[model samples]
Target: MSDAARRTVLGAIRHHLREARSAGDELPAVREAGRGPPPRIGEREDLVREFATRLGAVGGVAWRVAGIDGAADCVASIAAELGATRIALSDAPLVRALRGRLPASATLVEVADRDAIASCELGITSAQAAIAETGTLVLDAGMERHRLASLLPRVHVALVPVELLVADLDAAFAAYATREVPAAITLVTGPSRTADIELTLVVGVHGPQALHVVLIDGA
Candidate 1:
């Protein structure tokens, strides 16, 4: 077509698109079905266990630890039992403490390189908080640094400080909004699972196949 004709056609198309977009009806009102149940708060230890249990119910496992040494021991045992020799770790102080404790045979990963993650057997990191009601683990990505490292591996381990546990999603959201921009925030509920095809349950299809939560009592 001639240049002037093409311009006229494009202009008409753009106008039509704008009109169609503006013609959409308003969305329906959203209302809570009922007043929600009272929010439940737990002691740090209990919150950790609750998070662990929730993950476990969805096929993930969790462990509670007393301190640094305990965290190392926990990782070592899991690596040994699961025959995992490679692990990815966030560049955080508490996780760095695990350096001395990891088995020499176990290789440590610090960055979030995709190949490095795929080669590794496990990924380990820390989180910003744990939401009990939704069984979610929150990660302030920039704050945590290696957020991708935690999500991109086959097996993932987290060293959760007890004080980071919150009652529910709302509280978690409030905490996040008031805090500094975390770079990236991830709310991981369980091992990645999907039933997209023929209603078949598949685990690790979208993300890590296994999630191991290490809720440290006093880190």
Candidate 2:
């Protein structure tokens, strides 16, 4: 790409846009015209099951538990399996409630403690919303320390209530639109992954090696 070629392309794009606007066509109209029909999700489909399947397909684990106690037990079992000595926890109320139920073997550390976060083996936080279609967990920055708690650890655990689950991204977006936007929003589908030029797949290179999501009922 030469500079001249780049300028030509940009100029062409501007001309096209101007022409469309002069013809009473707007950007939204163009976008709507180009968009395809939304995906059809069966009304009877179990969102939890759909989310679990999609998460599994992306190399993440998902569990549906009966209540907070069940969620605690699941987290404790995972911590035991990983032999995590230090766990980082975000400031979300749902995550805080699990503090009393955590295993004694692992010490809980605040996500804001930079030194402690560096040594933490696992992170536990709460997700604001989850998309069943893609098995994505939506984390809002409004919840203090969730970003570091989720990202800077070997293992990440997300405790999501059943009511927060949505059928697709459209529904998730609509839900967010009803409230004030956060400073940042992160959508995580699975553990971090990257591939080389040879198409070789690698996992956990950029973020947590393992991701565990527990969906709690009767929140």
Candidate 3:
């Protein structure tokens, strides 16, 4: 509130930054030491199973399809079931592949059109990476315009290549650390949900009511 208080806060931040720089290469090691042992989730199929299980537990649906065509078919089936006429799609290559495969009744809306995306019944996007331990889908803004598409629709569909699946949050962060960090990284585990003080749970209060994850096995 006061100028003196602001100066004190800034001074503390500067001192912390100086100490952090002094740690140099040892900083990563220190940070790692503070975290306990990572979870022992198994490899390949096991990871997929775990991800699906966790996602379902949180009110999300998961499907493992054979290829891109299978993914398209799955999307079409969902669109038919929901009677979705307008679908918001991201600009990602994988997501674009489903353009012609959707049902004739459904129309594709580009993610760039914010107004259309807001009114769409379904949103389709590609996941940069997925965490098996928590069943989280990582959407990178640097990769495409996926934020609004994933958030503004009644149902959200994410196409994730099998290769991008990671064992845990640690592995996901490690993968991100290899490159320049994106401006925004969204970790979505399930549909939006909230509860009142009496603990009466409600879904789709702020975002999509349903989340569907289609993991392409050999894409």
Candidate 4:
């Protein structure tokens, strides 16, 4: 671009800023802070229900359970639905309960070889938090095992406590503001899908074919 064109663009931007300031539209604090309040999504909607609706719209499944016991029941039902006789498992307490409820023939592989995990029909782990606004589950992969189990299987099942549900992404991050940063963090809003080619939606293109979240009441 020519020098004259660059100056014209700068002049237009400065003029706009001046007009905005004069109209009292300039929020210096928020601008300096580099962030502001997120858009309100749960103002009139029930958060839990909203989360489920959003999740379903994205081709993911969600179930709200009474508590941990209900979660175990839901896990069993999901296992039957998927015809999964073997599953990769995590060590979280919520995950453990699901493991215990599996049938005698169903095996839970806690310490798995990569090939075994990839071959399993499903994988189960617990979410660090669930965002109601976008139906996203936040996973802190501080323990390396959870990362592999959540990703290697054909289906990824997440058990999240009701108390861990937050109204928005900001609230979710605020809950862990004081915690030490993990080696990795994953935010999953739905099942792995892509529509990049000819706008044809394909599930399980890069990750699990299915993503299920069972929300339990007890935290």
- Each model's lDDT: 0.80, 0.87, 0.91, 0.83
Q: What value of lDDT does candidate 1 attain over all alpha carbons? A: 0.80
Off by over 4 Å in 3: 1-6, 12-41
Task: Give one digit per residue, the lDDT tens place, for model 1 in 1-219.
Answer: 699999999999979877876899454556866435545666766776677778788887777788887888998888787787787888888888888677788888777677887788888888888887667889887676766777777888888887888988877877645677755788898899999999999998868898888888778
lDDT, candidate 4, at 81: 85
**1 or 4, greater by TM-score:** 4
Candidate number with the higher TM-score (1 or 3): 3
Model 2 CA lDDT for position 2: 92
Candidate 3 lDDT tens digits, 1-219: 699999999999979988988878344335565765765556889899989999999999999999999999999999999999999999999999998899888888974878989989999999999899999999989988899999999999999999988899888777765787899999999999999758988888889999999999888
C-alpha RMSD in Å of predicted model 2 compared with the true structure? 5.0
Please rank every candidate by TM-score, starting with the best: 3, 2, 4, 1
Please state the error at residue 37 of candidate 1 in Å: 10
Quote the positional error of residue 136 for candidate 3 in Å: 0.8
lDDT of 2 by residue, 127-195 (tens): 998899999999989755698889989899999998888888877776665788889999999999988
Clashing pairs in 2: none
Candidate 1 has a TM-score of: 0.78
- TM-score of predicted model 4? 0.78
Best TM-score goes to which candidate?
A: 3
Ranking by lDDT: 3, 2, 4, 1
Q: How many clashes show up in model 3?
A: 0
Please estimate how well model 4 matches the true structure, expressed as its whole-model Cα lDDT: 0.83
Measured by lDDT, the strongest candidate is 3
Estimate the TM-score for candidate 2. Answer: 0.82
TM-score: the better of candidates 1 and 2: 2
